[model samples]
Structures are given as structure tokens and as C-alpha cells.
Target chain A: IPPPMRPIPCKPLFFDLAGNHISYPMDEIEEKAGTSKKSPKKEGGGITGLVKGLWGWGGK
Target chain B: MTTPTAAQQKKEQEKQALYVELQKFCQSQDDTRAIKVASKILHLFPNDEVAFKTKIVCHVNRGMFAEALSLINDTSKLSGSVQYEKAYCLYRLQRMEEAKSVLDSWQSNSFKKVELMYQIHYRLDNFESAYDSLSDLLKTSDDEMDDERRTNLSAIAASLKLAGSSRRVKDIQ
Candidate 1:
């Protein structure tokens, strides 16, 4: 059945090494939900990679 | 106890290497090859938790619940718990009572668990409890999820009403 959409999908939950339950990461969740923010057309050959790299450092 | 001999140590090393290959296969979505590598690891070490789980996941992903259940049943112990997965397999197999009991065994609540319980209750024609479960889900959820669950709650309510009406009609008959 196609489940109702949520902040997270109602699926398997796993534990981290420390044993705290964790759901799927946002990117994987988005991808599974077909609502990914990634552009369909790749932006340049590698420019998007560079931007994501910069964002990962600054955003965190 | 005697220490593991060199041959046993070498076998352990090979198992570790196969696990690495299994990881790569899983990441690449090569579940077929991943299952083979995981089976190899399991052959070398039947008590391997990672290999057992990887194999189960591959089968579950393929919708081969029976195969996954076989693996789960054959193993006496899994280093990591696969209780939830076992419930899912039973649910898919249409063993509602078994599935419900497995879920009931859980002490804590999660969205998936509650949702599944709601489904199981609905299938068993226990509309009242199904509605209760959905309402519980509705109250706990927030924002985007709340709307969807509210809709589900109403649907379950409708079912509850329908079941009541049917019972009333039966009494009249």
C-alpha cells in the first residue's frame, strides 16, 4: 500500500552503534518519497559537487 | 579454552574480506551478488550478524518474505535484533495473529509499528481498536503527518460506523 506521506516514511528503524534508534537520513527519505531536491539535469559536469561540498562544510 | 589456530585465524580474515565485498555490493544495489557474498560469510561463520541481516534485507527488498523468514527461523540468535523484520514478514504472509502478537511484544511505540498494528486490526475486523490506534497516531504526529493521519482516522471511523450498522442489521434480522 502507498502509505500516507510524513516527515519520515513508516518503515524499518535501525539503531546506531550507541543503540539509539535512527530513521533514514533526509536525502534517502526524500529520494524514496520521490520529492528529492536534486535537479534532474546535472548542473555542469562537477559544479554541483563543488557546491554541495561547500554547503556540507558550512551548513553543518 | 584453546586459542584459535592459524588456519582458523586465516578463515576469519577471509570472512572479514568477504564482508567488505558484501558492503560494496549492498551500496551498489547488487543484491544478487550481495546475497551470495553474505551466504559465503554465513557459511564461514554461521553466527555472523551482519551477513545474516544483509541476506535478510536482500530477500525482503525483493519481496521474498518466505525466504527471509527461512533465514530468520534457521538462526538461533542474531547479534542484532530482527524482531521488527520478523513481524513484517508475518504481516506480509497474512498471519495476522502472529504479526499482531509480535508487534504487541514491543514495549515502545514507533510510527511504523503503530501503522502496522492498525492495519492488522483492520484486517481482523477489529475496527474499534484500529480506530483507536489510528487516533493515537493522529494525536502524536505533527505538521505534514497530522493531515494524512486525520484523514485515516476519519476513514477508520467510517469503518467503525459501518461495522456497527451491520451488526444492528443482523440483530434486526
Candidate 2:
């Protein structure tokens, strides 16, 4: 058996719609987009919240 | 008992009609039409989960991950599958760590989750773990393994075996 490998710190590579491989600096993108710091608050409430609670049907 | 006002009845009928149209569009896999109907429904009922989910699927199918992510972010409450979809968007965007973190946060046993985990582990160069995940997935009944999934498992297995043997040969040399 091959010895266990250590996890390497590497950036992930994404594919575009054209099936081209592209590398992105996610940390910088997140920092600039403000997603790295905090998530946005969800909108609406009550019946909307209740309705939005259903799962696994159309979104699959 | 008080009867619904004319306007209320009209609104209810419209909602029902929109839902019917949405279902038809989705069933036909007409994502563009489905999205349009879903957006209309969502506009009228912002919290409609089915419409939101339909819209998300349409965006994802079109490879609009950024749009899908944005929609997921706008939602306050996420259903299990929606969370999975969000993680998938992250994974497709090449935010592997973020994708892993999201999947980790959710205590799900979905095949999609397993597949995503396998991909993430493989990309992270954790071949052993990746192989283990793929093995677990393959162990699912043959009926559950579609042609594409079976092919993917075989390909990953071959790649892992090639890597392992090459490493061993280097060690021997």
C-alpha cells in the first residue's frame, strides 16, 4: 500500500462553461466580495420563511 | 365563516396557475421557461420554496454558479438540498476548502455529498481518502450506480492505482 499522503495546501481549479480549467485566488476574491467576513441576512419572514423551508424537490 | 374577498380569490387562483405552469416547465426540463414561471411565483410569494429551488436548479444547469451562489446567499433559511446545492456551487467555483467546510457542517448522507467529498479529497491529493470515499460510493447497490457514476469510479480508481504504483516504483529505485 502507498504510504499516507499529507494534505497539500493548494488552490482549487475551476472549470468554465466552456470546459476550460481556470485557477482563482479565492481568498482574495472572498475578501473583496466580503463573503470571507460575514454572510448576508436572509430576506422575508412568516409564511415566506415557512414556504422556503420545504426541500429536495425542484432543486435537485 | 367569512368568505375570501374577490381579490384574495383571484390571487389564490393566480398562484395555483403559476404553480401548474412551473410544474409543467420543470417536468419538461425547459429550464428557461421554468425559471420564468418560478421567478413570477417568487415575485408574488417570496418564500415559495419550490419556485426558489426551481430557479436555483435552472441557474446551476446553465453553469451560472455565481448567480446560484448569490441566490443561495439571499436566502435566510436553507433546506438540506439547498445547502448541498450551495456547496456544489462552491465546489464548482474551485473553492475546495469552502466546499469541504460547507459539506462538513451538514450532517447528510446523500450520494451527491459523497460524490462531492470524493472530488474534493481527490483534488486535495488525499488519494487514500478519496479512494475510500469512492469505494464507499461504489459499494452502493449496482442499481444505484448509474453509467456515468460507474465510469467516474473506474477512472478515479485507475488514477489512484497508477499514482500508488508509480510512487512505489520510485521508492524501490
Candidate 3:
């Protein structure tokens, strides 16, 4: 006859931490990664682009 | 066409056109447009009774009964038929005192006056009063009434009889 199957018990390897999956001090990590969050600046373009920019500013 | 004076002919044409516009507005339920057009007509011919009458009708259609009463207040200048029509509007607006006062001032020998009084009484739910008044008028004009007026009087009399019998039976039980 075949042997009866045995049950297996294992300890949990991972724990659910605090509020979200991400930890605090993310900006410190970003600095270590050599990345900056500043947006690119632009000079004046054509009249159409200027008008579009004015419209965008108006919408805001 | 040729015999009438130019001014008279022009005034007739204007009245005809105004009447057409009034009819159109009435059928289309365009009370605001009717008031504007009637106002313009009155401006052109200040003493035009028909235009003023049309204005009252427009006001009445728009549920502006107060305006209609104010416009129709110049009873001395208005034709008898116009005053009668104004009284009808007052009756519809449930202004029984105003309607009664106007009808009292009117001479009631004519069929129009009798009809107006009958309408007032009928609207007030005073069927017996209407019957009495109509009977008095019909009694006075039995020999002289034309066919249409006589027929109307007869119909009212029949209605009064029916109402009277039903009312008497109800009272008896």
C-alpha cells in the first residue's frame, strides 16, 4: 500500500509592515540615486506656441 | 375699396393685418409676441380699440388677469362688446364682485348682457340665480329674440330645469 500523505508546517517569511509598501525617507533615496525633480525651462517659441501657452495659463 | 377715404382704408388694412397676427399668436400660444405686436399697433393708432382689446386677450392668455383688468378699465371708451368680453375675463379670474359691478352698470336688455350675466352666475355656481336672471331676460324678449339668441335661451332654460329637478330631489331625501 502507498504511504499516507503527511502535513507540512512552515513559519511565515514576510511581514505586512506600516501604511503602504513604500517606506519613509524616499527623497533621501532619490538623492543617493543622483536624480533631481526640477522641470525643464523653455524660451519663447512661435506666436502660435505663445498663444497656446497663454491659453494653457488661462485654463489654469 | 374706392369709395372709402385713404386714411380709413389704411386703418382697415392695419386692423386686418393686426387681426391676422393676433390669430396666429393665439393659435401658436405665443403670448409675448402677441403683446409686442399689439403694443406696436396701439402705438401707431393710439385710440385703436381693437388693438387694446387684443392686448387684453393676450394678457388674459398669459394669466396676466390684473393687467387685463387695468387695460379694460376704460369702459366708457370701449365698445359694449369689448366691455362684455372684459367682464368675461374677470369672471374667469374669479373676480365675482368686479364682474357683477360691471354687469350691473351694463344695460341688460340685450342678449349679450344677459349672456354675460348668465356666465357670471354660472361661474359662481349660482345656477338658480343664473336661471332666474336668464328667465327674466327671456321673458322680456320672447317676441323680439332672433333665432340664435332664442336657441341659446332655450338651452339655458333646459339646463336650469334639469338642475332644479335634481336639486329638489336631493333636498327632499
Candidate 4:
């Protein structure tokens, strides 16, 4: 009997996500709750906190 | 008996505050903090669905499969997605039989469930079931992941046609 040829590799999933690791669909839980990537509305927030968080203005 | 209205409102407000914190932790991808906040929410409101889910997902992201599985078992009447989580935890724990059992009870033919089924079967060396799952994925897959799915399908078919698995490539095809 002839030997069967080895198969090629499949495309990678998730591409090295830090926490999720693989394409585990972990975010589906948040998405269904209408909460994925969206922060709860904070009161009286303008641009100060955003800038500080973005560039570490005060911490650095 | 009903509680006083003001107290009830205060409790509601408290729950909202914890839930909002949980949401913030999730947004930041601070999974450990998310788990802690979610545990707080669940302690306060045991029936909070999103809190339960958030905690479970955090456990998984941290590779705490055993913890996630224990929590899933202790809870009652899990949602379909949560049931999938249970199966996933079992699979990650390398308990293939229990994982397959959980998946066998799954009613919906969701893409996630099918993909997981394929993985579990593959891990158990059940190539036939894996082949069938890949076929199902091929039939229902969107363009977003069709290429990967096809590659997996061909790989499974090729391996099965060999002496390792009894099923022929033509049989799976």
C-alpha cells in the first residue's frame, strides 16, 4: 500500500491575543450584554481624564 | 414580605455601582480585577447573569479551567452559552468524555458549539466525529473563516484516508 501524503497546516486563530490567547469567543459574552468595549457612562467627564489615561500625564 | 422602598432603592443602587465597576474592569481587559468585581456582584446579586458570565470568562482567560468548571457545576440551569463554557472547561481540563457529554446535550447547532465539538473529538482521537464536525463547519461557515475551516477539513480528510484512521478521504468527502 502507498503511504498517504501529510497535510498542510491550517491558518492561525486569534494571532496571539494576550488574555484570550486563542479565538475563544470570550467577548461574545460581553457583546450579548451590550457591554463589549463600551464603558459605563461616567458623570461629568470631559477630556482631562481621557488625556491622563491616554498619555499618563500625571503618573509619569 | 417586601422590604422598605428606600432600602430597596439603595440596594439597587449598590448593585448598579458594582455592576458598573465590573463593566469597567471588563473594558480595561483587567481580567483578574474583572473576576474580583464579578464575584462581588454575584455575592450581592446571585442571579446576575452577566456577572456570572464575566467571572467565568475571566477564569478561562486566566487558564483557571478547574475553577470555572467547579463554578459551572455549582450553578443551576445554565444558559446555552454557559453550557458551552462548561464543555470548554471540561475540554481544557482534558476530560474528554465529560466534555463530549456536555456538548451532546447541546440543542443549538451554533458555530461555536460545532467548532468546539470538532476540537473535543479531535483531542479524543475520534477522527470520524471530527471530520463530520469539519463538514458541518464547511457547510455553515461564513467567508470570515472559510479558508481556515477548509484547510482543517482537508487536513482531517487526508489524515483519515491514511492508515491511522479507518475512514477514507472519499468517505469523509
Error of model 4, residue B142, in angstroms:
1.5
* Docking class for candidate 4: incorrect
- For model 2, how does the per-residue alpha-carbon lDDT over B79-104 read when each residue is reduced to its tens digit? 45477778778888988899889988
What does chain B score (TM) in every candidate? Answer: 0.77, 0.81, 0.56, 0.86
Residue B123 lDDT, candidate 1, scale 0-100: 70
After superposition, which runs of candidate 2 have C-alpha atoms over 4 Å from their true positions? A1-60, B1-6, B78-81, B144-147, B158-173
Greater lDDT among 2 and 4 belongs to 4
Task: Determine the backbone clash count of candidate 3.
Answer: 0
Best by DockQ: 4
Off by over 4 Å in 1: A1-60, B1-5, B142-151, B165-173
Better of 2 and 4 by TM-score: 4
For lDDT, the strongest prediction is 4
- Model 4 agreement with the true structure over B27-47: per-residue lDDT tens digits: 678889988877887787788
The positional error of residue B57 in candidate 4, measured at the CA in angstroms, is 0.7
| Cand. 1: chain B TM-score | 0.77
lDDT of 3 at B125: 58
How would you order the candidates by lDDT, starting with the best?
A: 4, 1, 2, 3
TM-score, predicted candidate 1 vs. hidden true structure = 0.61
Q: Please report the interface RMSD of model 2 to 1 decimal.
A: 15.0
Top-scoring candidate (TM-score): 4
- DockQ per candidate, 2 decimals: 0.03, 0.03, 0.00, 0.07
Question: Over the stretch B1-173, how does candidate 1's per-residue lDDT look in tens digits?
Answer: 34568778689668656755765676677778978987887888887666677787777767788988877887858823666677777877989899789878976567777777777887787877877776676667565545555555555556666556442211110
